[model samples]
Target: MEWMSWTVPTAAFFIVIGLILLGMTTWELRSPSVLRKGLLPIATTRGDRLFIGLLGSAYLHLLVIGATDWSIWVASALSLVWLLAVMRWG
Candidate 1:
């Protein structure tokens, strides 16, 4: 079960982040902030939803890579910034 040492913690971390984002999204939907009220609103267009999903996945994967030290944290940070930029600009 050598993989568990890696997979378990990674899975737990992903779950935690997923939960955090879910709660944040829910809160934003019920009463959106300035940013959420703009792009990522509850009634998002299909393209917006796809963009959000892809960015969200990329963000989470980059976070995992950051945690595992397979790469620099800068990449993950930049990925997060990229997600925000796309959500804002798209």
Candidate 2:
């Protein structure tokens, strides 16, 4: 279709998301997660933390881009850190 064009970065993004889903599926099948309270206010399972992390990363990227004159690399780095923190202790 005319709207189906895929840039390299866009394709790579989807590929990464697919891989994350696949890995999460495998992990869940191998070892199930238990809901636990972390630094986050609510109890979360692995998937819950993953969702929060991804959402927070998106917000962090937006904030970095909108609030600073920094480069995209800086925003990407901040987003990565936010993702890691959320995954670890969210």
| Cα lDDT, model 1, residue 31 | 75
Best by lDDT: 2
Taking all chains together, each candidate's TM-score versus the true structure is 0.42, 0.90
Q: Write model 2 residue lDDT over 1-90, tens digit each, in one string.
A: 377889998899789979998999899999999999989999999999899998888898999999999998899898889888988888
Worst 10 residues of 2 by lDDT: 1-10
Write one digit per residue (lDDT tens) for candidate 1, span 26-79: 876887554234444465643454457566858776676757765655556666
Hey, what RMSD does candidate 1 come out at? 6.9
Show how many residue pairs clash in every candidate, following the order shown: 0, 0
Best by TM-score: 2
Candidate 1 residue runs with Cα over 4 Å from true position: 1-3, 7-12, 28-71
